[model samples]
Target: MEIEAISRTYSPEMACVIFCCRVFIKTAAAEDLEQFVAYGDIDWNEVYRLAALHRVRPIVYRVLNNTNIPEPTLTRFRNYCRALSVFAFERQIESARIKQVLGQQGISVRMYKGLDFTKVVYGGDISLREFTDMDMMIAPGQLSAMVNVMKAEGYVCSQVEYLRRFPTNFVTNKKDICFYKRSPMGRLFGFEFHYRPTNFMMDQSPGFDELLGKDSSPFTHEQYYRLMVLNHGASDYYPNLRSLVDIVMLSQGRVVDVPPKLRRYERLGQELASRLLNSPAPAVPADKPLLKCATLITEWQLTATPRSGWEKMYMHIRFSSSFLHTLRLMLRAMHYFALPNEKDINNVQLPLFKLYYLAKPVRLLNIPSRLKKVFS
Candidate 1:
C-alpha cells in the first residue's frame, strides 16, 4: 500500500516508475513491505526481489520521501544521502584545487561543473546531484599545451582505443575527458578541459576570441558569471535540476547588465527550464532522427532528470560506435530541448555528416587511395 502511496506522488506516465519501484524492492525493508501491502494489496516481497536487478538511486530517494515506509527504510535513505554528500563535498575540494592549479599556470581557467554548482540550485545541499568531473574551459589553441601541463603533473590521456586515435573531425565533434592520476592524492583528482562546448554542433557558435571578448568586457565579473551558468545549462545541456538552480542563485539580480545580443541566448536557458518541468521524457524516432533523441536526452539532463535510463543506455551504445554519431546526437538533442518545433526539426542539417561518414569507413580499409583523398 505504501508503494501505491509512493506511486501517487509522481506522474502516472513517468518513464522511470518501474525503475523506481525496483529500487523500493531492493531495500527489502520489512516495514516498507508491510506498508506497501496495507496500502496497495500488492505482493511487496516479490516486487522487492525483482527490483534487485536495477540500480536506481533517484527512485529510491523518491520512495523514501513519498511513501510511509518504516524508520529503518528512512534510515537507509538518510545513509545514502550522507554518503552522496560526502562524495560531493570531496568533489568540491577537487574542483577548487584544479582552479588553483590553473590560476598558478596562468591558464585563465573557468569552472563549469562541480563546486560552482553550489551557488546555483536551491536545496542543492540535499538534492541527488553530484559532479564527477571538474570541467574547465581553456583557449582553443592552448588545448594541447594545457594537456601537456596536466600530463607533466601526471595526468594521462584516455586510451580507450577509439579515443586513443583521433581524426580531423574529432576536434570539432568530441571533447576528451582527460584523466590525471597524480600519485596517491592525484589518483582521486582529475580534471576535464573542454576546448569545445557541447553546443559546438551549432552552425554559428562563437570562437575562442569572441568568448574571451565577452568574458573580458567591461561588464562586472558577476554578469560574466551568470552568462557562464546560462551557457552551461542551455548549451552544454547539463542534466540536473541543480544546474538551473546554479544559474538562479549565481545570477540573482545580476543579469541586468548583460550585453543585448548575449541576452538573446537566455531564451534557450528559459526553454531548457520549461521543458524540464513539463515534458521530461519525449518520444523520438531512431536512425535519421537519432539526433533528435540525443537532443532530448541532453535537454533533460540539463533541465530535468536524465531522459530515462533507457535513453542514457541507448546513447552510450550509439556514441561508442562512431565519433560522427556522437556529435550528431549531441547536436540534435540540444536543438530538441533548446529550440523544439516541427519546422525546426525539419531543418536539422549537420554539415560534416557526409565527410565524416565517408572518411571513417575508408580509414578502416587502410586503402591508400581513399586515405589520400581524405588527407589531400
Candidate 2:
C-alpha cells in the first residue's frame, strides 16, 4: 500500500522535538539555541523520545542543560549521557585493538562512525556520541582472514554475512557485515565489522574501496566519502537523526572539503537537515511509503501511549517492504517474542518452535483497522 503524509501532518509536540533536536545538532550558536528554546512549554517526554530514537542523547542533554527541565527528566538525561560515555570508552578501546591486530596482518582498518567521527562533531570530546559498536570496512579479499584473526583473539564472530542483511555491492561500495562479541551470550556486540560502506540506491558514489585500493588511511580528506554516507542515509530514509547531524557537522567542520563532483549529493543531505530545522512541519517522506509510515508512527508513539492494535498494524505494514515481506518479518518477530531463552531445550524443540507460527494471524487479526488507518 502507498502511504503518504498529508500536509501539516506532525503534531505540535513532534514539531518542537524536531526543531529542538535539529537546531542543536546543526549549530550550537547561542542565539539560535535561545530562539528554539523560547518555543516554550516543551513536552520533555517527546524530547526524550526524539533524542533516544535518533541516538543523539548527549547533544540533546547539552541543549536541555540550562533550561527549566524537571528534576527526574534531567536526571534521566544525565544518566543516559554518563552511561553512553562509559560504553563509548569501551568500544573505542576494542576498535583500537581490532585495528592494531588487523594492522599487524597488513590490513589498514579505517574506522568511521561512533567515536571515530565524534571528535569532529563534539569538539574532540569522544564521549559526546554513544558508541554501541564499531563499524569497520576492509578489503574484500581479506574478509575470511580477518574473521579468523578476530576469532583467534577470543572474540565470538557471528557467521552471518552482511549480504543477508544489507547490500554488499551497492551502487557505490562493496561491503559485507559481521558482528563480534567477547562471549556467546553477550547482550551487545563489541564490534560490527563491515568490509565496505552501505550503498545509496539513487546517488552513484565512486566506491571508496575502489579508489583507495583498501590502502588509504585518512578519511578526513575524503570529501566524496562523507558526502556518500550522508547521501546513503538520506536516500534510504535512515531513521536516526545522528546521520543528518553527521552531514550538518561535516559541512560545518573543516575536516573534509566537498569535491566538485559530489557537491550535489552533499547538498541533498544538507538541505534535508535544514528542512528539519526550518520547515513548518516534519520532513515526512511522501514519496517513500515505508518512510512515511515510520515518521508517522514515531510521531504518534512519542506523543501518546496505549497503542491500539490499529496503530501497531498501521506501522507494521509500512515498516515491511511488501505484503509478503510483512508476513515474513511478522513471523520472525513473533518467533523472537514468543520464546524465552531460559526454556528447557528438551521442552522446546523444533515442533514447539513451529507453534509460534500460529501467532501470525493473532498479530494480523485487525486487518481493516490497519488498512483503514493507512488509507484514511
Candidate 3:
C-alpha cells in the first residue's frame, strides 16, 4: 500500500510511524510524508507514544527531527536518542570486557541480535536500535565453564539460586540464562548467554555449530536473517512494528530461503511490513486469520490498548502452523506456568515443589490486575 493509502486506512500517528521507519524511503514516500505533515491533522503525542512503543524512536527522530513537530516532543526524542547513545557506548565497553574475561577461559563467544545488528545493519549507530541485553551464543558443552567465568568476574545470574538447586533440570529445559553486573560508573549491564539462537520446533533451524562455524567466526547476513525469522515465529510475531522492521531491514536486497516449516511466519511478517512500511508484499499470500490477529495486536500495542488474557492466548494459538503445533504450544505454556521461578518461590515461601506447581494457577489470578496496572 502507498503512504497516502495507509494514512487513509490507519490513523495519522500510525502513518507517520510507517513513513519514518522505512528502511529505504523512496522520493514518492518522502513527498507523501511531507504532504501528510503539511495537511493531515496529526496528534504529535500519539506519534511519540507509538514511536516509543514500537522501539523505533531513534529512527523516527532521525527522520523527523527537521519536521514541524512540537518542540517539546522533538526535544523528548532527541534526549532519548542521546541517552541511548551513551548506554550503547557503555554496553560496548562492558561487552569487550566480558569477551576478554571469557576468552581467557577458552570460551568462544558469538554476539547476535541487537548487539550485532546495531553495527552490521544500522552502520554502527547503536542509538537506532533498542535492546536490553547483549546476546552471546556459546557452545552447549561449555555452559558450566561459561557460568563460572561470569560469576568469577562478579556478574550475577538471575537464576543463580535456582540453578544451584536444580542445575540438571534447568539446563535441560532452558536454552539461555541472563547475567548482570554494575560497572564501576554504576551503570548496570546485562548479558544473555545462549546455547542456541532460537527455540523454534522447526527441524531445519540451524544449531550453534552451524551458526558459529568451526573457527567461531561471526554470522553472515544470511545466517542472521534465518535466525531473525525463526525468532519472529518463536515469539508469536511479537506484536510490534519493530519486529517486522527488523525482518525488512535484514531481508532487504537479500534472498532468504526460509524453510518450509517457517514460511507462514515469514509471509505474515512480510505482509505486515508491506501494509505498514510500504515494503513489497510477499509473493505467497498470508494466512488470513493469523495476519488479522497479528495486525490487531500490533495496532493495540501502538495505541497502548489493554488486552484480555483470552485475547493474548488466542493470538498465541493463532500463530501456530497446525493443530499439533497449537497443542504443543499450549502444553509448553502450561508447563512454564507450573514451574515456579525464583521470584515465585521468593514471594510464596512454598515448602514442597508439588505444592508450588499446584498453586501456580491460583497465583496467576493476579495477572489481570497486573495487566490493568501496566496499561493504566
Reference-based lDDT, each prediction: 0.46, 0.54, 0.72
| Candidate 1 lDDT, 1-376, residue by residue in tens | 1334334553222323343433333323535444543455333333332222222343445554656645665566566667666666676776677667767877777665445544343234533544456667776556655665676666665522222233333455555446656535333666777765444333355443444344533333354444553365335443444343334344444443333434333433444433432212223224333344345644344222535634543443353335775677666665334432222222333344343444443344657777689999
Stretches > 4 Å off in candidate 2: 1-9, 22-39, 160-174, 182-187, 200-204, 209-217, 221-235, 253-264, 279-376
Q: Which of the two, 1 or 2, has more TM-score?
A: 2
Candidate 3: RMSD to truth:
4.8
Which is the winner by TM-score between candidate 2 and candidate 3? 3
> Of the candidates numbered 1 and 3, which has the greater TM-score value?
3
TM-scores of the models, in the order given: 0.49, 0.61, 0.84
As a TM-score, model 2 comes out at 0.61
lDDT of 2 by residue, 124-209 (tens): 78877655767776766666677677778877643433222222322123344455665343546566665544431222445555
Q: How far is candidate 1 from the true structure (C-alpha RMSD, Å)?
A: 12.2
Which segments of model 3 are wrong by more than 4 Å? 1-10, 23-28, 200-206, 210-215, 285-289, 301-313, 344-356, 359-376
Q: Where does candidate 1 have its weakest 10-residue lDDT segment?
A: 339-348
The lDDT of model 3 is 0.72
| Ten-residue region with minimum lDDT total, candidate 2 | 1-10
Q: Of the candidates shown, which would achieve the greatest lDDT relative to the real structure?
A: 3
Superposed by TM-score, candidate 3 places the C-alpha of residue 60 at a distance from the truth, in angstroms, of: 0.4
